[model samples]
Target: MERPRYESPVERAIREAQERGEFDNLPGAGKPLDLGDTSDPMWWVRRLAEREQLDFTGALPPAVALRKEAATFPESLTALRTEESVRAVLEDYNLRVRRDRLRPPDPRMPQLLAPTVDVENLLARWRELRAAAGPPLAEPSAPEPRRRRRWFRRR
Candidate 1:
């Protein structure tokens, strides 16, 4: 007859928890795993990012990351307060795109080259959004001077 195996404390605790239904009805209990169509080697990293609500762009190639940023550039400009700041942001982005273009393509993702952004076009869009938002509300004027209390009555 085969000898019965001894259960460790940790294993016993886990078994007791399972018997108590502590592990049932948890999130994604019976759902099929969502491994994407292609068998990406970094599937676990992607899954961890999604589960933790993390931005996974930093893991992408520079060109691909820049392309993604460019796609959302207009929305990003909405938070800037002045044309100068907007121009500076676009110029910096264009500089980075130009620099990235000079670098040798990433062997793994050679097809993901990003083009430089058209600063003028983006600036026009920013202006349009700003105009549509209407002028900034004027600041309230200085409060009226407080009246002084008359301690002595005039005779």
Candidate 2:
């Protein structure tokens, strides 16, 4: 009996991503994906760009707004009202930052893309596609249609 392969966390994530319509509309079949963090906007932005197939290496401004918002939220909330107010501002600011980074999708990009689950699986698929598509070189081909002149001929 053939052994069933156990999926790694990364693989599992990719599978999940595929199920979700995350890549429904993106360029290069979503070859390049962007995701950033409100927790640490600067770091996450860089991380997202790095994970993409294409490299977006350039100088990045500090996420001053995000940093400021993050600082406002105290670890231990002394007052519920203060915490709520800070939370609201932080949420709005983070949303803006994310929107700015994503930008508008390019018209040339693919309408449907392979959903990315985990970083590893996404990279794996990218590498595989990059290598080339089609059957393995070692595999033998079936007889050509012309050579297969069987008793049952097409009318």
The lDDT leader among the candidates is 1
How many clashes does the backbone of model 1 have? 0
What's the CA RMSD for each of the models? 7.1, 28.8
Off by over 4 Å in 1: 1-5, 18-46, 107-111, 137-155
TM-score of each: 0.67, 0.19
Deviation of model 2 at 6, angstroms: 95
Residue 36 in model 2: lDDT: 44
Worst 10-residue stretch by lDDT in candidate 2? 110-119
Residue 142 miss distance in model 1 (angstroms): 14
The superposed Cα distance between candidate 2 and the true structure at residue 134, in angstroms, equals: 69
Q: What is the lDDT of residue 150 in candidate 2?
A: 67
Instruction: Write the residue-wise lDDT of candidate 1 on 35-125 in tens digits.
Output: 7855788888777888899986788789888988899978789878788999999999999988888887667754666888889999999
